[model samples]
Target: MKHLNIGLFGFGNVGRGLYDVLKRINSDNVTIKRICVRNIEKDRGIKAEFTDNPDDIFNDRDINLVVEVIDDAEAAYDIVKRALKSRIPVVSGNKKMLGHHILELIDLQEQYNTALLYDASACGSIPVIRNLEEYYDNDLLCSVKGILNGSSNFILSKIFNEKMGYKEALKLAQDLGFAESNPTLDIDGWDSLYKLIIITMHAFGVYVAPEQIFTYGISTMNDADIRFAEEKDRRIKLVAHVEKIDDRLIMCVIPQLISRNKYIYSVEDEFNGVVIKGLFYDKQFMFGRGAGGHPTGSAVLSDITACAYNYRYEYKKRNDSVLPRYTTEHTFRVYFRYKSAEQRNLLNFLKVREQYTSDEYNYIVGDVTIANLKAHQEELRTPDCFVAAYPFD
Candidate 1:
C-alpha cells in the first residue's frame, strides 16, 4: 500500500479528534502534513502543526489527501473542488456544502477521476452511506427513517424525560457543547433537513434541495406538548424520514411523537438511530453516538483509511428500473400546539382528530397535507407553539 500524506483543514473539535485518533492508531503509512485553521489565536490543546492559509494545503503536490471539516459551506466546497481537480482524494464532513452542491461535486469527481467520500456528513458514527451503497443497493428499499439531529434530541430528552423547560434544556445543551451559539440550524430543522437531503440521494439516488423537502423542528416546543406526549405515551424526537409513496419519494425532517414501543423512542441525548426498511427484510435498525468529537472523528478516520486504499462511492442505485420523484402531497398525522386561534388557523388540517385547550396552550391532533405542514413550519416554530408528526399508518 502507498503511504498517505494529508493536508487537513480546520483544527477545531472534530479536527483535533481526527488528529488524536490518527495518532492513537499510530499508522506509520499515513501522516498529516499540515493542518489549516482560520484563527491563530485560539489554542487547540494538541501540539500539531498548523497554518492560516488553505491554499497552502491545496496547492501542495506532496499532499495527496485533503480532509476538510470547516463551518463555511462555500469555502469548504472551493477547497474540496480545488483538491479534487488537483487529483487529490478528499474526505470531508461538511454536510451543508454537499447537500447544496452534490450534483456539482459529483461532476467534479467524475471530471477529475478523484475520490470524494463524506460518510461523516450525516450520522457521526453510523456508516449510512457505505451501507446504502453496498448492502441496500438492490434490496428494494421502501423507507428510511430515524433521528438525525443530536442537539435537538438532547434538548428534547431533557424536556420530556426530566420535565425541564425548553429554554432550560437548551441552555444545558449549549453548556454541554451539544448546541451551537446560534442553534437555528439544529433547533429549526435545517441541520436534519440537510442530512435528509444527503440520505435521500444515497438511499434513493435522488438529488433534491433543502427547499424541496418538508422541514420542521422543535424550536417552539412548550410544556403543554410535553404533557401531550406523556398522555399519549410517546417521546418527541427530531426525525428525518423518507418514504416511497407511489412514484413520489416523500422526504422531511421534523419533530415527531414516537410511541414507547418504537425503536427510535429511546434514542436520545446525542445518540442517532436510523431504520432502513426494505421490502424483504422489513426493517434494519442502526444506533450509535451521533455527535461529539470522537464519534465524528471515527467517521472521518474511517473515510481517511478508505481513501488511503482509494475507495469511492459507486452510487449503484442508477441501475434500478424506476427512479423516484420528490413529492409532499401525501397526508399524515400532525399535532400542533398553539397559544392563540390565529396560530392554530395558520395550519391547514385535512381532518381534525382531537382538540384540547387550557389557559396557556391549545393542542390539536389532525391530518394535514405534507405541503401545508411544511408551508407553516416557520409559523409553527414561533413563540408558544409546536408541531410534530405522528405515525400515518
Candidate 2:
C-alpha cells in the first residue's frame, strides 16, 4: 500500500490541527507534501513548504491526497472537484459547500473513480456519517435528532442551565472561540441546516435544500420563553431533525423543547449528541466534543486515515437510478413569540394549545402543520418574532 503523501489546502485552525495530529500519530506513514494558503505572509506556525496556487497540489503526483478547510463555499467545491478529477483522494470539513454541491460531487466520484470522504462536515468528532454509510446502510431509520451546532447549544445551555442572559451566553461562546464574529450562521440555524442536509444524504440518501426544510433559529427567544421551557422540564436546543413520516421525510432545524430525561437534554456547552432511532436499535446516542480545532481536527484525521485505505462512501441507497423526495406534511406543536397581534395572526395553526399574554410581550403554543409554518416562515423570521417547535406527543 502507498503511504499518504498529503497535499493540504488552507492552513487555518483545522488545517494546522491536521498537521499537528499527523505528526503525533502514524507520522512515518503520512506526510504533508504541501500546504496551500491565501495569505502566505501571515505566520502559520509550521515550517512546511507553502504555496498560493491550487495546481501546485493537484498536479503533484506525490500528493495523492487533498484536504480542504477553507471558508469559501464555491471555491472549496472547485478545489475538491479538481482534486477528484486529478484522481486524488480528498477530505474536507466544509459542510456548507458540501451540502450545496454533494449531489454533484457524488456524480464526480462515480465518474472519476476517486474517493472523497468528509467525516468532519457534520457533527464535529461524532462518527455519524461513517456509521450511517457503513452500519445503518440497510436499517430502517425512524428518526435522527440531535444538538448539531455547538455555538447554539452553548448559548442555550447557558440560558437554561446556568440562567445566563442571551447576550451574555452569546458573548461567552464568542470569547471561547465557539462562535464566529458574525454569528448568524450558528445562531440563525444555518450551520445546523447544513449539517442536517449532509446527515440526511448519508442516512436516507435524500437531498433536501435549506429552504425546503423548515429552519428557525434561537435568536427570537426571551426570558419568558426560557421560563416556559423550564416549567415544562425541558431544555431549548437547536435540533437538527429528520423523521420518517409515512413514506416521506420531514426535516427541520429549529430550537425545540426536549425533555430532561432524554440524552440530548444534557448535551450542552459546545458538546454534541445525536439520537438515532431505528426500528431494531431503539434510540442510540452518539456523544462527543463537537466544536473547536481539536475535535474537528480528529474528525478530519479520521477521513484522512480512511483515505490511506482507499475508502470512499459507497452510497448503496443513492445512485444514478433513484432518490426519495422530501415532504413537510407532518404535524408538531410550535411556540411563536411575537410583540404584536399581527405576527400572531399571520401564523396558521391547526389548534392553539396555549396562550400567554403580557404588556411587554406575548407568545402562543399551538399545534401546527409543517406546510403552514413553512408558508409563513418569512413573517415568522422577522426581527420581533421568533418560532420554535416542541416535542409533540
Candidate 3:
C-alpha cells in the first residue's frame, strides 16, 4: 500500500473535524504526520506533533499535503504561499484568504506546478465549484443567486418566527454559536460577498474585487417588514447574486422579498440554496446544510481524496484556462420597502413602477439601469425602509 503524509495548520473547530474524518477513514494509504497550532498546550485530543512554528511543516520533506483551516487572512496567506512554494499541495477552507489572494496563488500554483484545492471555501457541502468546472460545457450561465450566509439566514428566520427585532435575533444567533464573535462580516453581507467572489471566480473565471460589488445586511430589517412579507406570501432573505449581461457582470448582496413560489423562499434557518440558470438547462437548484465543522470538513475531505488520487495517478487539469475579464454594466431590478404611504409616493416620483401598500409598510419595485441609485440612497436607507436590487433578465 502507498502512504501519503499530511500536515495541518490550525486546530480550530473545522480543523479538529478534518482530523476526525481522516482518522475515521484511516487507511494504510495515508497518515497525518504533523499538526500545526498556535498554542500547543490547548487540549486537542489528537496524537500528532503540534508546533507553533510553520517552518516545521515547510521544511518537512516527508509531508506531501497541507490542510489550512486558519481564519486569519494575512497569516494564512503567508503560510499557504510558502506551502505552495515548497511544492506541497494545499487544501484550504479559508474563504477570506482565497477571496483576496486567489489570483496570486493561482499564478504561483502554475509556477510551482502544485494543486491548491479549496472546495470548502464558498458553499460548505454543495459542490457548486466542481460542478461548474466539470459538468457544464458550452453552457452560458446567465445568472447565479442563492441564500449564501447561514448566520444571516438564521437571524432572518428568528425575526420571521419569533417576531423579534434584528438586534435581538442577532444576539440569539451569536448565543447559538451560528455567528462569530465579530459578526460584522456575516451580518454586514461581507461574508456572503466573499463567497460570491469565490463562486464568480469559479463559474465565470473572473476575479472581481470585493469593493466592486454592492452589499447590504439585514440589520435594518424590522418586524413590520417581516410581517408585510408574510402577508404578501413572501419571505425576506439575504441573497447573493451574480449575472452576465452583454459584456458585464452584475452582482449584489442584500435582503430581498422572494415570492413563496421561488424555491429560495422555502430555504430556512442555516440551510442554503443556490439557483443557476443556463442557456441549455432550466434553473438548477442545489440545497443543503451550508455550514458546520463536520459538513465543511466533509468538503475538505473530498478535496483531499481527489488530491490523493491525483498524487497516485495523473489526471488532466479541469478547465485549465486564464481567468476571464468581465465588464459589469448590467441593469438590475430594485425592490424598495418603505415605512409609509408618503415614502412610497416619493419613490414613485423617482420612477418606481410597481407599488404595494400594507398597514405596516409600502414597497416599490423598479428597474435600475445605471448607478443613479446612490442619489436617492440616503432617503431609501432610512431606518423605516429596506432596499434590494437584482440583475434583470
Candidate 4:
C-alpha cells in the first residue's frame, strides 16, 4: 500500500472532525503527519504532532499535501500560497479565502504546477461545485437559488418552532451552538455572499466579490412576518440568488418570502438545498446537511482524496479561462417591504410598477433597476424598507 503524509492547519471543530473520520476509516494509505494550530496545549485530544509554527508544515520537505480548515482569510491565504509555491497540493474549506483569492491562487497553481482544490467551501457534501465543473458542460445554467447558510436557517427554524421574534430566535440559535460567537457575517448575509461568489465562479465562470452584489439578512424579520408569510402559504428564507439576465449576472443574498411550491421552501433548519435551472434539463435540486463537523469534514476529505489521486497519477491541469465580470444593473421584479408610510412615498418617485399590501407591510413589485445598488445603497437602507427581487419570466 502506498502512503501519503498530510499536514493539517487549525484543529478546530472541523479539523477535529477530520481526524475522527480519518480514524474511523482507518486508512493505511494516508497518515496525518503534522498539525498546525495556534494553541498546541489547548487539549484537542488528538494524536498528532501539534505546532504553533506554520513554517513547520510549509518548510517541511516530506509533507506532500496540506489541508486548511482555518477560517481566517489572510492567515490561510499566506499559508496556502506558500504551500502552493512549494509545489505541495492544498485542500481548503475556507470559503472566505477562496472567494476573494481563487483567481490569484489558480494563477499560482499554474505557475508552480500544483493543485489547489476547495470542494467544501461552497456546499458541504452536495458536490455542487464539482458537479457543475464536470456534469453540465453544454447546458446553460440559467440561475442558482438556494438556502446557503445553516446558521441563519437555524434561526429561521427557531422562529417558527418557538414563535419568537428575530432577535429572540437569533439568541436561541446562539445559545444552541448553531451560531458563532460573532455572527455578524452570517446574520448580515456575508457568509452566504461568499458561497454565492464560489457558486457563480464555478457555475457561471464569474468572479464576484461581496461588495459587488446586494446582500440583506434575516435580522429584520419578525414573528409577524413569518406568520404572515406562512398564512399566505409562503416560507421565509435567506436566499442566495445568482441569475443571468441579458448577458449580465445579478446576484444577491436576501431574506425572501418564497411560496411553499418552491423546492427551497421545504429546506428547513441546518439543511441546505440548491436549485439550478438549466436550459437543457429540468430544474435540479440537491439537498443535504449544509454544515456540521462531520459533514464539512467529509467535504474536505473528498477534496483531499481527489488531490491524493491526482498526486498518484501525476496529472496536472489548469483553468486558464478568465473569470467573467458581472454587472449588477440587470432589471428584475422586486418585492419591497416598508415599515413606515414616510419611506413608502419615496417609491412613488422612482417607479411604481406594481404594488401589494399585506397586514404587516406593503410590497412594491416593479421592473425598476438600480445601476449600483451599493453606491446609492443608503436609499435602500432605510429602516422602513425591505426589498427582494425575482427574475421576470
Q: Pick the candidate with the highest TM-score.
A: 1
Please provide, for model 4 over 150-262, each residue's C-alpha lDDT reduced to its tens digit, 9 standing for 90 to 100. 88988887677666567776777666544644687777787888889888777777676767777877665554456556765666789998876656677888777787578
In candidate 2, clashing pairs total 0
- How do the residues 1-393 of candidate 2 rate in per-residue lDDT, one tens digit apiece? 568888888877678777778777857778899988888888876688899888888778788889998877788999999998887889999888987889999999999999999989898899999998888743477788999899889998888778888899899898876774468889988889899999988888888877787778888777777878889878788898988655677898888888868898889799999999988878999999788777888899888889888888988766525445588887888888888978888877788989988887888898888888878876777767878787763
Count of steric clashes across candidates, in order: 0, 0, 1, 0
lDDT of 3 by residue, 233-335 (tens): 6778899988766556677777777887788988887778999988878699999777766777788888887787763211122253533345434455677
Question: Cα miss at 186, model 3 (Å)?
Answer: 1.1
Segments of candidate 1 deviating more than 4 angstroms: none
Compared with the true structure, all predictions reach lDDT values of 0.84, 0.84, 0.75, 0.75
* Per-model TM values vs. the true structure: 0.96, 0.95, 0.85, 0.87
The local distance difference test score of model 2 is 0.84
Candidate 4 global lDDT: 0.75
- For model 3, the superposed segments whose C-alpha errors exceed 4 Å read 162-168, 175-177, 311-328, 337-350, 354-365, 373-385, 390-393
Error of 2 at 212 (Å): 0.9
> lDDT at 172 for candidate 3?
79
